[model samples]
Target: MVFPERFSNLPEYAFPRLRKLLDVHQAGGDPINMSIGEPRHPFPEFIGRAISEALEGFGRYPPNEGGEDLRAAIVAWIARRYGVHLNADQHILALNGTREGLFNAALALGVEEKARQKPAVLMPNPFYQVYAVASLAINAEPIYVPATAETGDLPDYVALPAALLDRVTIAYLCSPANPQGAVATEAYWRDLIALAERHDFRIFADECYSEIYRNTPPVGALQVAHDMGADPDRVVVFHSLSKRSNLPGLRSGFAASGSGNIAAMKQLKNYTGAPLPLPLQAAAALAWRDEAHVEENRAIYRRKYQMADEIFGNVAGYQPLEAGFFLWLPVENDEAAALKLWREAGVRCLPGSYLSRAVAGQAIGQDRLRVALVAEEQELQRGLLRLHGCLYQ
Candidate 1:
């Protein structure tokens, strides 16, 4: 048997790499996991009732483009959250999760070649791993644009040369970005949309963490594009119930774009996608329809954010998270910091370098630790305190 060589250069996924680095050392105390972004908050109590009511639907084949009710619920949620109205049937495609949409959208919409050459996909250097793999899957060049402190913690794709810009097909952006927790501002979205219009590329807006913010709600790319009168298909935004509803196990999400783009993604999905089972879809629909639970969930995360700020306030380079649960704390060496925290304080975190790629022999993430604030309040506090003592002190 032969394995694909394209992915051979990719590092092992973040969590497994964390395990390999720390499993040999016995934790000094009771283990406190602050590594993965899986939410520890309780899901809505009504999810079970919704699932049970729809149990009979499982006997039939699931809808390839999500059930009507689920799509309507998502449509309504978007209107309420982003002030952008979209036709449920034309603009939305429910996903197994946003990861599916994020990866597959490239395949569905990315041009086979541009300017008589292999197209390029641009993503933030420390981006979600799916974007890079998706670019490689299509044999497009994956240009990793760094999202460092200097770039307002966002990738400045417009800064690239005109030669590369002309060849670009897709640009993946994460608002309330993973690892760093930096939210892209409205102006940032407008500038990027203009650049994409000028260069002719699609923007994959990963807004999974849009609801987990501490202050103002982050702006959505679709909303900005609509306001700017950019091409309706210019930005494809992916959202999820995983973070917003604390339902990672359900793996329910949706993509919103122009009717044509939605159709393209739907056509691709029909051949190679697992639609959410009817029961789970029912639960997800209810989750999307209800915002009380989301507000409650957001409140819990807000408390956690305050806790993290209070704990790490004095630590050098601790920028309070703008959104999402992860704290991308700067360190002299990420792997060393993570290992020291695990071995000495029983606090586990993912090394920042694991989430990023090296560029020009310089690893941008080599000096930071991405600590997830997803545990219960007490556990999260203890883990942060211990991490502070072990790494900062």
Candidate 2:
């Protein structure tokens, strides 16, 4: 049998591995799932009407990049949100979801070799899985940089040895990071941009959770790049409607960068991309233009964040999340704590070790559990309380 050895070494994905560990034991009480980050808030009321009006266009092939209205809406939103001006034609390309762009952009931009060695893709140790897979697909060495508590939950790419940095072609960064909710400050972005310029690598900013923060908006990579007058090609950002508009099923997102980067991505997409159905794209366009729904969504997440703080506030190692909804709560052992919570209370949460890899002898995510606060307030409260009782006490 022929098989691709490149992916054979990959661990079984997070959810399936979780099911194997916990499904054999009956949930001790009414099950409350806090494992997945899928948003539970209501999508905007206008989506149905918008989709209905555009239904006829589904009969025709949609544009590979995006229709004019959708592109304009994205550009306008960027201006309003980040205070950066961008040309719709040169700077943006619609994606089925940020995941697609995040994966494909590497293929489009990563060269076969850099500085006489295999190209390297830098990523946080406990990162979104797609980043590693993208690097593997291209045979690039996926360098897992530790983004631990000591590093403020963001990768310190600048500290890498200059020789390794010089071989790098891309670095993936997520702010309001998944699992851990720490955000990158403007100074953080500025330093990173400078580092990328020095090393000659492009920055892939995954800002999917940008809109789900409490209080001040997180600083964006594009804005910082613009402020520093960095080459426009230095940073490419991918954002999603999933977290912002509570539209995970919509599968709508966009990537923005210098024209050269966008053009390269567009060329690749022209051959193999699955453009969103015209009807869905219309709904997404409306979703992007309207800030009212996004604000309401943020308000819902804000209240949840408060509930989480109150429930786990006194627990010894609970880090108050700055943005994003996941609670990366500390534990003596992640897998055992998850099992105890599942067997004693019907609370389902993921063991953080599954999201990270071991380097040397220590796994970065071994002492934590990633709990999603995506349920309604009352249900979320019950889950968190049960988790607190079962794990903390």
Model 2 lDDT, residue 131, Cα: 94
Q: After superposition, how far is residue 269 of candidate 1 from its true place, in Å?
A: 0.8
Compared with the true structure, all predictions reach lDDT values of 0.92, 0.93
Q: What is the C-alpha RMSD of each candidate to the true structure, in Å?
A: 0.9, 0.8
Least accurate stretch of 10 residues (summed lDDT) in model 1? 1-10
Q: Which stretches of candidate 1 lie over 4 Å from their true place?
A: none
Off-target runs (Cα >4 Å) in candidate 2 are: none
**In model 2, what are the clashing residue pairs, if there are any?**
none
Local accuracy of candidate 2 as per-residue lDDT tens digits, 3-109: 68888778889999999999999998999999999999888999989999989988999998988899999999999999999999999999999999999999899
Indicate the worst ten consecutive residues by lDDT in candidate 2.
1-10
Which TM-score value belongs to model 2? 0.99
Candidate with top lDDT is: 2
**TM-score, each model?**
0.99, 0.99
